[model samples]
Target: MNYNSPHKGMTLIVKTITRITVGLILLYGIYITLHGHVSPGGGFAGGVIIALSFIHLMLAFGKEEALRRLPKPLVSLFESLGAILFFTIAILGFVGGYFFLDWLNKGEPFKLFSAGSILLSNIAIAIKVSFGLFGIFLVLVLLKFTPKK
Candidate 1:
């Protein structure tokens, strides 16, 4: 059998398990990010989870597949977009005469939308973190790691 196939990576068992679990992992990450305001997990945690899912894919299915799903350019674009979004949100606070102010209406407490601008900030942070981490991972993987000559 040809071992150099782009689809080739880990063994069949690992591939099967990864295929099954990756979606669930991604969903769980989204859940943690969206419900962070009400729960303990927040943007950073959720973003790490999300990046791990992609990293898991890369490990199990090889970099080709993972990069195909989330190309490097798209990753950079998203990271920049996240920063822009966070900055824009902060700038909007200028209307309240301060930076990073909670300018939006705070909904009923303990509810999903209760955090107002915080929720948006969390989303922005998640976007930035997830993509930034994944991008860094890609760079490291591409780097030639050589031991002493």
Candidate 2:
């Protein structure tokens, strides 16, 4: 297994195209995640897109390459961390005497950096969903179903 070239799974054209578009896809996911509070899409949708980008890497290059980019241990770490972060954020609302309360100062409306903890909450959810979906995909890909003769 040549760790240098993860593009061995698909044809040259697919690999090239994936290499070019994967970044854009991931970036778009981030954009959707960030703009979720005001836009139609939210954290779950963005996270799925983000996970799709990684799956696209696996389809274009190979599982080894995708795993190289997102290892099992890291996935596990992020899974727990994201959950904890989200829980912590919700818990922080206790200062305002409520669960999942909006205590932070919400800036001007329609601005990129506005909405306070909403954006942070969206981010945490995105991280958790992305890692969870990606991990599920990896498991399915790794599953070896025996053929019945």
Candidate 3:
């Protein structure tokens, strides 16, 4: 629960560099998530990048600081919301009388915001994965720092 860890020894410059790297990674994650439907990147890849951002922050600073940036409750809410959104989208296809059908408008290919259903799915997945990984990471960090009984 302590933000100031006694184990930290990295110089200010190193910490600054690390923070910059983490910020870049987070931006990349958002890019991947947004462009998932049009390119090779997707929810999973974007989610991993998002999680890596937090991981990098945790490594550079500490668990407490990372948690401050991304609280457990918020992450958990996002995870649940993402799951619900994904399921709702999937259900829409079924309600439309097609199994796993792509309901959203599939616009021109190679466009930034084309492929509506695919984009929606990718976004849902990204949110789910990012929050899920963050939750897991938070738990692991807590366990690692907990004092032995």
For model 3, where is the 10-residue window of minimal lDDT? 1-10
Off by over 4 Å in 2: 1-7
Task: List, residue by residue over 12-127, the lDDT tens digit for candidate 1.
Answer: 88887988999999999988998889989988999999999999999998877777779999999999999999999999999999998887899998888888898898899899
**Each model's total of backbone clashes:** 0, 0, 0
Residue runs of model 1 more than 4 Å from their true location after superposition: 1-7, 146-148
Question: Which residue pairs show collisions in model 2?
Answer: none
Tens digit of per-residue lDDT, candidate 3, span 34-78:
988777899989998998887878777866677777888998999
lDDT against the true structure, each candidate: 0.89, 0.89, 0.82
Model 2 local distance difference test score:
0.89
TM-score of each: 0.90, 0.92, 0.84
Indicate whether candidate 2 or candidate 3 has the larger TM-score: 2
By TM-score, highest first, what's the ranking? Answer: 2, 1, 3
TM-score, candidate number 3: 0.84
